[model samples]
Target chain A: MSLEVKTNVAPSKTKVMTMKRLKRREKIEGWLFVLPFVISAAVFFIGPLLVAFMLSFKEYSYLDMVSMFEAPWVGLSNYINAFQDSTFLRALLNTSLYSLGVVPIQLFIALVLALIVDLNIKGKTFFRVAYYIPTVTSTVAVSVMFLFIFKTDGILNKILSFFNLPPYNWFGDTRLALPTIMMMAIWSSVGLYMVIFLAGLQDIPMSLYEAARIDGASKIQEVLYITVPLLKPTIFFNLVVSLIGTFQVFDQAFVVSNGTGGPLDSTMTVVLYLYKTGFRDFQMGYASAIAFILFAIIFILTLIQRKFFGEETEF
Target chain B: MKKLIALFTAAVMAVGLFAGSTFKPAKVNAATKKVIRLGVWASSPAESELLDNQIKEFERLYPNIKIQKLVITGDYNQVMQVKIASRTEPDVFYLDVYQAPAYIAKKVIAPLDSYLDKNDVKDFEPSLLKGFTSGGKIYGLPKDYNTLVLFYNKDMFKEAGITKAPTTWKELEEAAKKLTKNGVKGLSLSIDAARFIPFMFQSGAKINDGDKPVFNTPQAAKGLDFYVSLLKKGYAATPKELGVGWNGDALAQKKVAMVIEGGWMIPFMKDAAPNVNYGIARLPKGDKEGDLVFTVAYAMSARTKNKVEAAEVIKFLTGRQALSMTAESGLAIPSRISMGGVYTAKYPERKPLVDMVKYSQVYQFGIKSSKILDALNKACEKLYYKKVKDAKTALDQAIKEVK
Candidate 1:
């Protein structure tokens, strides 16, 4: 009876094991598909982040290559210096003001334009493409164009001359430099947010609007009730992205000021200051500290935003 | 009696305050066959061309070596510091005579005492040589040098009823005022920081006290005020107002009657505005009566894989052939005395450059020169743009910011 049981090791059992093997093969193929992206994230993103965090505690310079590891560790000294650095403080303040100045104004302008474009109008595609051109153009190209238009003898002044209005030294004047940068930032970025808003506007349910209109709800009231609530997710995305982008703004300031953060360093941003500290001053450790500080600021702000606007808070 | 005692005590204190300490040279390897990479500022096309050739020659002469020339375009010093910190430093790089001390103290660039002892550098200009000498050791040798030349548009001068260039500040002011008209500015001085070095030097204003800022002097205030006055009276344009990179272009287009630019501009002006009649002359003297001369030199890099070869390359680049080649390239005035004559003999139109170099006084900002100048420039920008009116207060603010 025992011999008969051994011989009768079922064909069904073998078939079941083959079926399990097929499922495992499919799972392996899925992992293989994601392998490239995972490897890249590990090497480029995670590795540098870990190193930068470690570097924040050291005193380092390119001249002393090995000094990154060999140099005496001075915990919190770089952070202390960054706090004490009036320039760094000023950069932080300017960056904050710029973020405050740009994000809301740009978002509002973008939303208005998006709403207009969303209306039943002829050549809507043409208008959309025209509005989106600046968004796709290179930052350097846009910056150079703005530079000429705002020059003392450039077109802006020429146009201003028609009305007998005095011209402004956009970049040279310390008081105006930051504001001028903000204006340029708005011009370059508004189009991007506009497209997003357009998409969000389209996603709102037509049924709700129909119901509101039938119930004698005013346009403003309908928009407030239906459009905004439905577009909450989109608004949250733009807000977080804008916050991150504005906090780390470097290119425009660098190009406009010719890398000096000049006209009295009034146009200096945190990223610019970080660059100066890292690359200009050769205080890599200090620069690393600044980088981490910037990261922390962005991370904390993002967290705050998530808490305020996350999925948990349905409104 | 108490007042006299107080005065005496104050006098002693003042003297004590001025008792600035001297620098003691650090110990460095002299005998080892080490490699040092040198970085240099590539201001014009000529320097880059000559540097490449010099490196090749050095390699051929000393085959047991590798010499790397890191060419820096704008903000070379700032870039060099980063490279140095990364231990990817050039052994020798362009050190502005006024800004060399900080790097010297940082010990990023080693002293050339042993090298200087081994080589005879007597043929080089004594004044130029002395500018790079600190603690009785030469750090680098000047490769290309410049002094401010009054590049005047002869057509504008003619239209304004002026035939000759201004030799003094009084004459210059008068010429500028006469040249002023609708749609045309008299001068193209940028109130930005680049002008501060020349302006301060021209007016004989000192910028540093050891490592500290000391631009609170009456002379410093006077210089800054003079700069502001030029903008206020419509003699010059703010960097932003005129647009950045407008100085040469303005002069070239005859938009501005005159501009104070370096010797290198001789070639640029000739090419850009060939139709516009122009001539070069000495910079209008300041109240203190000296012209600001700017010189950049080639030094061996500290991180170069071949120090002997790199030094050889630096020497070759600053030598007669390279100097003449640089001069012939018509980019800048060469450091070697003979190169100037050779260039002039070959190109008579460049005779004005020779005259400009003769009256050129060295720009000595001690160390922290770039930062100090940047601070002053920022202050000037504020004043010229009418952001601030009180020159003394602005200058004081600048001094404070720098400190």
Candidate 2:
């Protein structure tokens, strides 16, 4: 009789009635909860984003901080020039390569680590903390450490030479420099994704795996069918986030190359090029243009990625 | 509504408290005592002490003026840029001559032609003073300068059976070759344009034509080829290859036998490699003669309110006595040409750097010279890493990119 009565009215209708009753007090509390983030985002992030958008069309240098209004507007010329700029194009290509190289490898390593840590194993907290340490450590410190170990005559080469292994010039080689940086990025960031995946893994109910086991599923079959599909949303989230992070890679490349983005500009990511243009060359307008273009690329790519993952969450 | 208002007020107070005083523009508050904020960067305590003593002497000369020294905490040029733009820059600040053209064009620094007298102008080295001058208006007065010279490890030279320091390009190459033995490098070379420009000048190559950097000519290419051959022939290696921070570091650690450095090397050598006996010589002559002079000046900011006091500080700081004191500390050679004799006599090792001042030129090109620098440096790395086999291809590619 209670079930039949409950079925007579929509759950959303009851929710709406309650929502209206509590609107005055609850609205204030809700606003108070989110107000800080809203204000900060408006001031710091959105404000600069709008300014950058406006500056993308103007011929402004950083010489005058208040020259936003005074700088000449050249329509979309700055954007046009960015496309024509071979160096910027090369930077774009390098950044694309970096994103491609870093995102998947980091994602895979992170998931494998997550799976390993999720087990009923000994020293579980120890493994989790060990993996997470790199994420918390400063990028500059890690780059400095890498520089010490990977330098031509460094300890790594000394060890390699002791065993008659050929010493690799890690950063000097144009082919290896960007990949080596990518390796550092992967090593540093894989842990954060692992933590995220670990959280997602715990959310998966034991009943699903038990049902699979009852159906005579093997361990690999249980994982391939149940675990991976359950973690798809988490994987998608990490992929998009890492894609953005990798595209904006600067500090590692900067510290490694001494801010020249060298080894023939092989490690010159878009952000590094944008930094050189805006700060070093004082071409703020052109750099803003490059920034907006990078923004468009990330935005469109994310939307496309959402199309593949966002539609299939009902499993 | 009253409760809501109270909550909002509390939140506002909390938010305001979270933000630090850094948000406040540095508007001076003292009513009677005029203050002049001086911005400086010092790596060592001794350097800071020397500067502090100079400031004390200046303040003693003028009792009314209170100088506040702001020790810069980051990249000096970038910091100064932001400060100047925000109108919060110090009254007097350090300005590198290499960066003078960009700053002068932006009108961030004051022109001190009227403040400086003829006697003072004549006293300064013409080349060094000229670096701070643009279109007959002086932007700053140089405190001191450094010209690059060859620094050789005496013990390594003896080991290699090279008694005297290399005097010519051929001899320099041969000495480097002879020193290339065991696990040590013959020389530590830098791929920076500042280091390479001297070689171009030595080869009778005009790095600049009118307002443009024309660094791809045959003579400059020859200089580039010769420079790269040192690395290619295994006679020289970059500091990174030797697992050192810089050429000086390599020399200090005895990983390299030779390096090209300047006056700062004196104090640095004393601190870093005090046990190692080293000698300085003028950069080995190429076809003709050339060197590089790095100079810095104490310039008044354009936005300085107390222009008179700032100019006075600049004058007192750059005066013969103050600069002579700076030179005495083995920090740098005073910009005054007249101080050259006494300075060299006191520290004979710095004589080569002091003597080469007449031959070297300040690094200057017209406004918006970024493309030239970027292109040339990329070319340098390409040659340096052996990505480009020959100098002509690399030089031409760099020239084409610039054009």
Candidate 3:
């Protein structure tokens, strides 16, 4: 009995010690693996975020960099001025309008695209790759391509003229400049959302649709009653992501307007305006304030969006 | 701005060349070796080539110093501001006269009083230095300058049944009307302040009255109206309308019969459209023949580690030998007032551009230059598109936005 007890105690103790050692090594390895990313994220992303936050409270410009830390602290005045600034307000309105115009249309088109592509159609792979091409292409290249396509004498105008419609200066008109870019934004991003919705469409069990079919449901009825209801989470996700994306629309507007937000600033989105304020005007403090204000708007809007779909997001 | 992009690309190529050379360790005395970085913009390969040659010559002159040439791409002022903010600005950089005032006010560039030779300073065009001077201190030394000139395709003029280039605004309009046929617009114009302000000066209108910005006054409208009327009447179209990159590109592409550009267009024409048969002339006379002078100066960094080396590089770069290369490049007129005659005599065809230097004013706005110019350009666009009813209202809107 003593021999048996000694054997059990000795092996068990050694096993426990080895297990402890393995766990510690694993933890260190995990940290080591992530260390490079962590450092970069801190330096590039988190560092700027923290600095921008601090700067929002100060009154600094490009020339005030050496005296950046010592620059005057104006508390909420920068934020106050942002609200009072007509250009800022106009930018805010333009961005809000752009988002409002973009999100729903994008989501609907993506859903439709996803639904169509999910079907057992001919050349399915070809269609899938074709639809996703724009998503994979660089945004600036796509923007430039679109600029050529939508210019006054571009292919689109030529196509219009073939049907006897008048050529429009898609980028030159203030009324149409924002919309032209909005259309480009929609065209470029709808593919990504379609991919998201494609995954959502494929996730639904065929049995649910089979049951709907058995109950005499039509194709639209099946999509409406069962597929869409079950896809609530994907819909919610796309909505939130698309909402955030639309709020930060800059590159398309920047490329289209050449960073001037021309045609009477109609193409001036909030982020573009913030860029012009900070980089162009060199009002870093004011730019920081504008950034934070945009952040607040995005945050509140996201919160509201979450509330609308929060319960459905749960498993 | 587009020229800056061209410069940036050329700079990238130049950087590649420098990088290739740097891979081989030079057998030099480390104790005596000093490196100074020179920054500039190049509109054409010729400009870059000339700079490279001058840099090599400079290195040979000062065996102890190595010069690193950098091109500040895109918005020159914006990039410089960022570089200045980061305290990593080049030892010497190109400072646009338009942006000189802001840099001067911010004390970003070192005053050249101590580095200057009084005789050398005297040789620089007084108008060129005016933008870089503040409180009796000169912050930059003008390296080169350009004045706007009319670039007309001789073939296009011939086809339009016109023998010579338009000298007066009315003649330009008539040429444009004749050129509007054959799907070619008479003129290529940019709805920009840099292009339009000369017209404003030609309007014989006062830009400001007692510190009150009054471009909205009826007299000032004369310039904007003439500018926009060309667009309205379908005689002149913007580069955007013609689907070209710029006034120079438009001329090269035959999208427009005539364009207003500076010496920068010369090398571009020789390279891009050598067979286009274009002639250069002073910008068509408005009421008073006012032209805007586009110039850049070599400015020393206020916080440079190699201030002595930097000053030496600037002095050499802006000196007579380097400027003679500039005059030869046909990229721009050298800043040395003495070189104007030499450059014109050397390239007899560019006499129109050189002659305008006497009548032209420096193209610069004090502070918030970009904002004011942006406003003015936007107003011009509005007028050109017929979004606004009248030039007066557009001018009013421009002044209001700037205010």
TM-score each candidate: 0.83, 0.92, 0.90
Q: Taking the tens digit of each residue's C-alpha lDDT, what string does model 3 give over A186-267?
A: 9988999999999988888888888888999998899888888888889889998999999999999998888888778899
Score candidate 1 by DockQ.
Answer: 0.22
Report the candidate with higher DockQ, 2 versus 3. 3
Residues forming the 10-long window of minimal summed lDDT in candidate 3 chain A: A1-10
DockQ of each: 0.22, 0.31, 0.34
Cα lDDT tens digits for candidate 3, B200-266 = 8888865654225667777678888998888889998888777765788789888888898887787
**Which 10 residues in a row give candidate 2 chain B its minimum summed lDDT?**
B22-31
- What are the per-candidate TM-scores when only chain A is compared? 0.92, 0.90, 0.90
* The candidate that achieves the highest lDDT relative to the unseen native structure: 2
**What overall lDDT goes with each candidate model?**
0.74, 0.85, 0.83
**How far out, in Å, is residue B395 in model 3?**
2.7
What is the per-residue lDDT of model 2 for residues A146-237, given as tens digits with 9 covering 90 to 100?
88888888888999999999998888778989998999999999999999999989989999999999999999998899999988899889
Going through the candidates in order, what is the number of backbone clashes in each? 30, 0, 0
Q: Per-residue lDDT of A252-274 in model 1, one digit per residue for the tens?
A: 89988888787778889999988
Model 3: lDDT of residue B263:
79
Better of 2 and 3 by TM-score: 2
